[model samples]
Target: MHDAPLMLCAGEALTDMIYQGDERWVSRVGGSVWNVARALAVLGERTAFAGAISRDRFGDALWAASEAVGLDLRLLQRVERSPLLAIVEQGEPPRYFFIGDDSADLHFDPDVLPEYWSRDLRWAHFGGISLAREPLASNLVALAEKLKEQGVAISYDPNYRNLMDERYAPTLRSMAELADVIKVSDDDLRGLFPGVPLDEALRQLRAAAPSAFCLLTRGGQGASLFHGDQRADARAPAVAVVDTVGAGDASVAGLLHSLARHPGRSLQSHLHAALAAGSAACLQSGATPPPPAAMQQLFELLEGDAS
Candidate 1:
C-alpha cells in the first residue's frame, strides 16, 4: 500500500433531510464527496476534504461528522451563508430534491486553498452539485487542472443533481477531461449524454477524456470498469436495502481505499470492492457510511466467491 494520503474530496458539504418511515424527517450531514471522504476515513485510509460549509448549525454538524469519521478538515472553509440541503425520497427508484440557493458551497474560492498542503496525494475527488454550480465549479476545474499538472491522480463523480442548470454541461465536459478516473451512475450518464446508448456514450466520453479510467455504475445490476483497452464488470451482491442514499459515494470511497491498499491489484478486484461498499451502503439509512470491518469483509467474501 502507498503511505501517501489516498484521497482528497473537494466539493459541497451539506445536510440531507431523510424521511424516517413516519411523517417526520431527520437532518443528516451529507454531500457526495463528503460522504466518500468519510467512507475512506472509516476504511483507515488517509483522506482530506476541501470544501465550503456554512457557519450555521448544519455546517457544525457536518464538521463534527467529518471529524468523527477521521477525515482531515484543514481544507474545509466556513462562511456566513447556510449550507445546501437535499430531501431524499424512498421508492423503487430513489429520487432527490435539492433545496437552497447561493449557499456557501457555491462560493468556494481556490485562493483559499492552504499553501502548506502537499500536492502528492494518490487521488483527488471532486464532483456532485459542486461541478454544476458557479464559482465552485470553476474553482474545482482550476484545482483539478493544477493537480493534473502535478501528476496527481484525479477521481470525479458527476453526482448530477436536478437543481443545476442544464447550461452547465459545457463546463462539466471541460472538467471531465482533467480526471484520471471518472465514476458515474447510469442516471448521471443518461442526464449527461441524453438519448445515446451506454456504449456510445462511453465512447464519446472516452474520446473527450482519453486518459481517464471510466467506471459506470448500474445501481442494483452492478458496475463496470474501463481502463486502457480493458473492461471489467462485477455484480453487486443482494442485500436488505434500507436506503440507497450515499451508495455511489461509498462505492467511490471503496474503489479509492482498495487502490490505496492493493496498488497493483487487478481491475476486477477493485470493481468488486467498490460493489461491496455500495451494497453495504444500501443496507444503511440516511447518509451514514458502512463500518470499515463490514467493507473489508464484504470485499473478502466477494473475492472468495469470485475466485
Candidate 2:
C-alpha cells in the first residue's frame, strides 16, 4: 500500500550470452520488459520493475543494473534459482536459444502487487516471454485485466521470440484488445503473419486492438504510430548500429516517457521522441538508453525536421 507507482513493468529479466566462438562469450542483462523499465528510469520516469529476480550472480547483476538506473525495486521478488539465459547469434534479425526451465522469472507472483497500486499507476507495460509462459503469463494477463478495470493505461510490446508460436495468436489478440498502446517490430509481424504484408499485418493488429495506439518499428526504415484516423511516421537517421539488442525496448520507453510527461499532447508529437530514443539505443551496445540531455537533443532534432 505504499504510494502507488506511476509506471510498473511486469515480465522477465534475463542474461543474454553472446557466443563469439572459440569458447568466448559476452553476457549482458536484458529482457524486453526489463530493458523498457531500465530505459524509462534513465529517461527520468518514476518506474517500478515487478518481476522475479534470482539470487544467482546473473540476478545480482540484473538487480544492480536496475538500481543503477534508479528503478524502484521493492516489487521485485528474490528467489534461489538460476536466472534465465539466452544464447544469441548476431545477425540481421538475430537468433536466440533460450536456456530456461523453471527459471526464477517464471515464478513471479502477481498477488504480490498491492491492490492499491492500481489507483496511482498511470501506465503498466507487459510483454516478451512473460505472455508466452505458463503460470507467470497467466499472472500477467490477470494483472493487465485488473489494471484495465482500474482505468490504468496498458502498453504492450509483442517482442516475439519463436518459442511462443503455440499460443502466440490468441495471446496477441488478448493483449491487443487490452493494451492502450501496442508496439511491435517488423520482425514480430513477419513471424505473426508469416506471408502477410506489413500493411495487412498492421490492419490485423488495428482490428484486434481497435482502441489502442498501434506502432510498427521498422529498423532503418523508421517507425509509424497509428491511432484511429491519425497517423505519424518518423524515419530513423542512418547510424552505425553497435547491436540492435534493445532498440525496440528503448522505443517503448520513449513512448511511455512521452505519454507520462505530455499527457495532453498528440501521439504524433510523442512518436517523434520515441523514434529518437530507439535510434539512440541502436548507436550504443547492449540495452542502454539515451541520457536525458541526449533525449532532449533528439526531440530538438525532430522539431528541426518538422520546421
Candidate 3:
C-alpha cells in the first residue's frame, strides 16, 4: 500500500497434502511462486502472492500464512471456486498430482490488482504449475511480456513438473529471454529438458536467456551463477538439513532480493546469500519461512570459506 518497492510472484497458491505414513498426511500451504513471495516478504521485501485461492479451508490456511509472512494482501485474490492442491506421496523422491479443475488459481483476474502496482515494482517472478495450465498460463505469459515492456525486471523459475514436458520448451525459452534473473535446479533442468544431456540442456537454456543472471542450484552441492562470460560457484555451507521443501524457492528469493538490494555486489556474494538462505530453509521443516538470524549465520560461514 505504501510507495515502497513491490515484487510479484505470479502463479498458483495451493494446499500441499504431504503423505506421512500409513494413510496419514499433513496439509501445508505451498506452491513455487507462493513460496518465493513468502520467502521474499520474510526477508523484508514488500512482496505479493499475485494469484487467487478458493474461499475454502485450504484458502483460509493459505491466506493466514501469507499474512503471517507479511505479504501485501491487496495483490491476493480469493474466489468462490475449488481450491488447488498438490497431493504428495512423499518418498526418497516424492510423487505428486495436482487436484484442481478450473480452480480459483485459474480465475485470477490481473486487471483487478492494485492500480499502479507496477509503478514501484522491482521484479516480477513467474513459474510453477500455474504456467502449465491454460487461460491462466496464457494470461501470465502475456502479463510477463507486458511488464517486461514496461521496464520491470523479471525473474523466472520453471520449477518443472510432469505437466511441463516438451510442450513447455517454448515457454521456457521465451520466458528465459525476458528474465533478468532465472533460477533452476539441476533436477529441474533434467525434467524440463527431458531426453537431452544435462549439460546440453543447460547450454540451450542459457542460450535462451544469455543476458539474464542464471542461478543454477544443485541441491546440497551448492549453486552456480552465470553472467555473460563469467561464472561464479559456491559450495553450500553444511547444515543439518531438516527438509529441502522450499530450499530452491528460498535460494531464488535470496538471489533476487540481493540483486535488487545490492546490484553492485559481486555475483559470488549474491550466490553466497542464496546458498545461505537455501541452507537456512533446510534447517526447518515444512517450508517454513526461514529466520533472518539463521540466514546471516550461515551466510557468514559461506563468506569465511570464500575468504
Candidate 4:
C-alpha cells in the first residue's frame, strides 16, 4: 500500500510492567507479533502492525515505539478502550498476570485496514496469547482464513501462555494448518499440549500441517526445521544472554527476513540466520529486536562456523 511490499502482523500489543524493587514498576512496550513486526522493520522490510492500542499513557508508549520503528501507522488502530497490561508483579522468577478485560487489542477491526492490502502483503503473521484471548482470536482466525483464500502467505507462532487453556486447542490446530510457516518453541510444545511428549506434540503438529515449513526452537539446544519428509537442524551460537524476553520473536522474524531477502537460499542457512538473530536479541535486555549489525555479526559467526 505504501509503494514497497507490505507485511502485516495482526495480534496484541500491550504494556509490560516490570517490578523495579520495593514499590516501583516500569512499563515497556511489548507483544509477540508486535515484536516480530519491529524486527522485520529493523531488517528493512516494509512492515505494518494491524493491532489496536488504547489512547491512554500505556498506549502512547506503544504508539511512539511503533512510530520510531518505521511501521506503517495507517494500518495501526487507535481506540478508546483500556490498554492491556502484563504486570510482572514479582521480580525474581518473574511471576506475572495480565490486567485488562475488553481491552483495545480486542477491539481491532480488520475491515478498517487499507483496501487491497492483502494484494501487496508478502505475508501476514499471527499468534501470541491474542489467539487465546477470546472474541479477538476468532476475529483473527477469520481474517487469516480470508487472507489465505486470497493467496497471501501466512506465518504463525503460538507463543503459549497460561491463558491458553482447553479452549485454545482448536485455534492451535486451525492456525497450524492455515499457516505457510509455523514456529513453536520446545517450551510451547509442552505448555500447549500438557502430558504429551515433545516428539508426539510435534508429530501432531505435522499431521495438522504437514506441508507447512515447521520451525522447532529448543532454546540453548538449537533449532530444527521440517518441510515435507525432509528435516534440517541448526545449532545455536552460545551468547551471554541479558534476557530472553524477545528472543523467539527475533528468531521468527529472522527466518522471515532471510526468506524474503534471500530467495532461493537453502532453508538450512535461513535457520542459522534465525538462531543468530535470536542470539543477538539476547545480548540486550527487554523485548527489543536486534539491529541489523548485531544480527549480521552473529549471522556471520554462525555461517562462518558452519562453513
Candidate 5:
C-alpha cells in the first residue's frame, strides 16, 4: 500500500467522443473531476471519486478504469441511465459539445453519501458540469459546505461549459466563498466575469473568496498563484503539444499533490510543480494523466531550474 494523501473528488464522470481527424470519433472515459481524480491517483495520491454513474456498459468501463488507476470507488452511485458524452474538437483552443440530457451524473444525491466517504480526506474537489447541472449542483454545493465545516481543505475548478444557465452566477459566487483553493483558466475567468480585466478579475475573485488561495491558468503560457499579498507566476516549459484535453485538470492535481506533500511550501514551489505536471500532460494524446515517473522527472527538472 502506498502512503498517499487522501483526496475526495465529487462531480461528473462520463465518456468523451474524441475527434480523430475528419468526421471520425473515438470514445474515451473522461470528465473534469474524473481527469483530476485519475491524475491524483496516478501521482500516488489516495483518491476517491463521488458521483452517480449509469448502469450501462460505459459506466462499467469507467469503474474499471478508476479501479485500474487506484481510485477508490466506494462513493460511486449507479443509476439505470446512460453516462454523459462530450464531443471534443481539435483546435487552437479545443471546443467540447456535450450530448447529455438528464444523465446519471446529474442525478447525484447528497443523501446517498456513504458513511465512510468523508472521514480521513484531507482535501475535496468539485466543479465543472457538476456545478452547472441540476440536482447534482445543489448536492455538490451542500457537500462542499459540509466538508468545509469538517475542517477539510476544499478546492474548486470551474471547468465551465456553455450549457450552464446565466443564473449560475450566484452558485459560482457561493462555491467560491466555500473553497479553500480555487483553480480557473483564463477562459473560465473571462466567462465568469465578462468584460473584466485580468487584474481586476483576480482582485474580484479574491474579494469574493477572501480565504481561498486562487490560481489562474494561462493555457500554453503557464499559471499564476495568488495568496495574501504574495503572488507567483511561471511559464510552462515549451514542449511538443499532443492534446490539451486534460491539461488543466492535470495542473490541479499537480498543485494539490505539491500542497499535500509539502504543506506550507513557498508559492513558487507549488506553481513550478503545477506547470511541470500540466506541460507533461500536453505530451500525451488523451485525458489520461502522465505516469508518476514522468511527474517526478519534471519535478526534478523544475527544482534544478529554480536552484
Candidate 6:
C-alpha cells in the first residue's frame, strides 16, 4: 500500500475559461479545493488531491497539472463525462458562471478512497461550490466525519459565492461544526448573513462551530483568526495586483503548511504565514502558485516585518 499523504484535499477540479480580451479566452485548472491542494504541494507539503475528474481533454490537463505540481494523484478518479467549466470574467471582484451539470467533479465516490489513507492523513480540507451541490456535498461531510473519528484534523473554507447562497447557511454550519479550522471571507459573512453586522455574523458562525478556529479574511485589508478566547489578525502584504483568483486558497495552503509543522503555535503566527501566501498568489495570474524562490522571498519579508 502507498503511504498516506499528510493532507487530503477533497472537492471539485474543473476547467476555468478566463476572459482575456474582446474575444480571447484561456482555460486553466480551477476549483477551490483543487487550488488549495495544489498550493500545499507547491509549498512543499505532502499532499493528495481527491476529486472526480473526467477522462476528457480538460481532465487530462487538470491531472497533468496536478502531477506537475507533485500532488499525489492516487485519490483522483476519472470518469466519462464532460468537464465542469467556469467562465470567469476578471472584474473588480471576478464574476463566474459555471457550465456543465452532472459533470465528473460532482461524482466523487467517498468509498473509492483507499482504506489506509486515513492512517497517513494529518489533515483534510473541503468546501466551495462542491458543498452547495448534491451528492458530493453529503459525501464530503461523511468523509469529514470519518476522518474526524480517525483523529485527523479537518479544515474548511466556506469560500461562499452568491451562486451557492441558498445552501450556504446549513452547509456552512454543517462543515464548520466538524472542522478543526474554518476560513471564511468577509464576503462570505455578508452572503451568509445579509442583515447582520460583521461581528454578529462571525459570532453566529463561531457559535455553530465552537470547537473550530474561524479565520475571517478581509481581502486586501488582511485576515483575522477567532478561536476560544484567542484572536489574532494580520495585514495583507503589498504586492502587485495580478488577480485575486486563488488568494484565499493560497492562504489556506499557507496556514496548513504552518499547522503541519507548528500545529500548536499561536494564531498570530499562522495568520502571518497565511497572509504572506495569499498576497504572494496575487503576484501571479490564473491561480498558479508563486515559484519557491518567490515564496521564500515573501516569507523572508514577513519575518522582517515581524521583527
Model 3 vs. true fold: TM: 0.97
lDDT of 1: 0.81
lDDT of 4 by residue, 1-307 (tens): 5463478889999999898888988988999999999999988889988889999998899989998989887878999999999988775655888987889998999888777666777789999988988788999999999989988889999998888899899999899889889999998999999999999999998788888888999977889988788788988888888988999999999988887889687778888888888888999899998878988988888888878
- True lDDT of residue 63, candidate 6: 93
Q: Candidate 4 — worst ten consecutive residues by lDDT sum?
A: 1-10
Tell me the whole-model lDDT of each prediction, alpha carbons only.
0.81, 0.85, 0.88, 0.88, 0.84, 0.85
**Better structure of 4 and 5 per TM-score:** 4
User: Which regions of candidate 1 are displaced past 4 Å?
Assistant: 1-6, 19-23, 89-96
Question: Alpha carbon lDDT of residue 9, candidate 6?
Answer: 94
lDDT digits (tens) for residues 183-227 of candidate 3: 899999889877889889889998988888999988757789999
- lDDT tens string, model 1, 1-307? 2333547889888888877787988888888888988988888878889888899889889989999988887778888886798887754466767776788888777786667474557789888888877777888888888887877888888876675556877866776788777888888877777788877877887776776778889876788988888889888887788888789999988887877788799999989888888888887886778777777778888888889
Q: Which stretches of candidate 2 lie over 4 Å from their true place?
A: none
Pick the winner on TM-score between candidates 3 and 6. 3
Question: lDDT score, residue 277, model 5?
Answer: 83
- TM-score of every candidate: 0.92, 0.95, 0.97, 0.96, 0.94, 0.95
All candidates in order of TM-score, best leading: 3, 4, 2, 6, 5, 1
What does candidate 6's lDDT look like per residue over 1-307, in tens digits?
A: 4777999999999898988888999888889999999999999888999989999899999999999999998899998888899888866676878887789988889887777776778999998888887788888888988899999999999787767775556777788888888989998888878889998998988887787877889986778987788888778878888887898899888888888888887778778778878888888987887555666677668777877
Cα lDDT of model 5 overall?
0.84
What value does the lDDT take at residue 251 in candidate 6? 87
Error in Å for residue 269 of model 3: 0.5
The prediction achieving the highest TM-score against the true structure is 3
Backbone clash count, each prediction separately: 0, 0, 0, 0, 0, 0
